[model samples]
Target: MTQRFEYDVVVVGGGPAGSSAAYEAAKNGVKVALLEKEETIAETVRTSGVTWIQNIKEFGIPDDCFNPIRNFSFCSPNNEVTISDTVPRAAVLDVRKTYRWLAEQAKNQGADIFT
Candidate 1:
């Protein structure tokens, strides 16, 4: 016989938003299910993988997973400018690792993850 499971909340996609939602819901004792059509999470690359430092801290992303960028360069047909900041203003992430981490978090929180 096949077993059936019911969920109070169903989140589609295994991206950052979906994983976060499922994690929060399950952590709060809700029966949450996260679905991903991909064969594996983070298999597809959709984002530029750039995020701000504030967001990284706020989201508790690990430092090892990203590289800090304190300098930026802007170029035009006739003009080019470069600027650097004392503190890292942005970061470049390993998208595959980042998504996997988020999915792991959601799973650890009791969210049923389906890939």
Candidate 2:
């Protein structure tokens, strides 16, 4: 026999957007479910994982999940330049870990996550 489930809100995918939506909905007392096609959210990587440091701080991203990028380089046929800063303006994240963290947040908020 097949099992059936129902929810007030059903979110597709397990990416940041879906997880965030589910989390917020559940926090407001709505029954929410998040569906992910992947067997595991971190199994297949798809994101470039580059983001600003300000975003990291605002989102409360863990320090161990990302690498700070304090320098950047750009090159062209005739000109090339490299810029460096004492503090990191941006960072490169471990996409898998980030996604898992967001999903976990949603789950903790009472959102049912299905992978």
Candidate 3:
């Protein structure tokens, strides 16, 4: 059997960028299809999973969804660097869960997601 799909917009990967693109396009009333190679979207994380706290807030991600990083350190053979913040500057999101959230948003906007 051969199946065919036609869409006004097709977004690939289903990562944050793709999901957001599909959501935006679909919300504008365009037919959108989001294609993801993974059997389960976000089964693997492609990102470092660390982002600024401000970005997390702007995206409406709940505080509990990520763990705040308050201290960090990097060391070389002869040198070292360390950073400590009174408030967390970065947070590590539960990538799989986060991706699902983004994909859900796209689906709610009428984007067809295939993973």
| Candidate 3 ranges beyond 4 A from true positions | 1-4, 78-81
Best-performing candidate as measured by lDDT: 1
Q: Weakest 10 consecutive residues, lDDT, candidate 2?
A: 38-47
Q: Can you rank all candidates by lDDT, best first?
A: 1, 3, 2
Residue 1 error for model 1, in Å? 4.6
Query: How many steric clashes between backbone atoms does each model show?
Result: 0, 0, 0
- Summarize candidate 1's per-residue lDDT along 65-87 as a digit string, tens digits: 79999889999999999999988
> Alpha-carbon error at 34 in model 1, in Å?
0.6
lDDT of 2 by residue, 32-82 (tens): 999999998777777799999899878777898899998899999999999
TM agreement with the true structure for every prediction: 0.94, 0.91, 0.84
Which prediction has the highest TM-score against the true structure?
Answer: 1
Candidate 1 segments exceeding 4 Å error: none
What are the C-alpha RMSDs, in order, of all predicted structures?
A: 1.1, 1.4, 1.9
Name model 2 segments beyond 4 Å from true: none
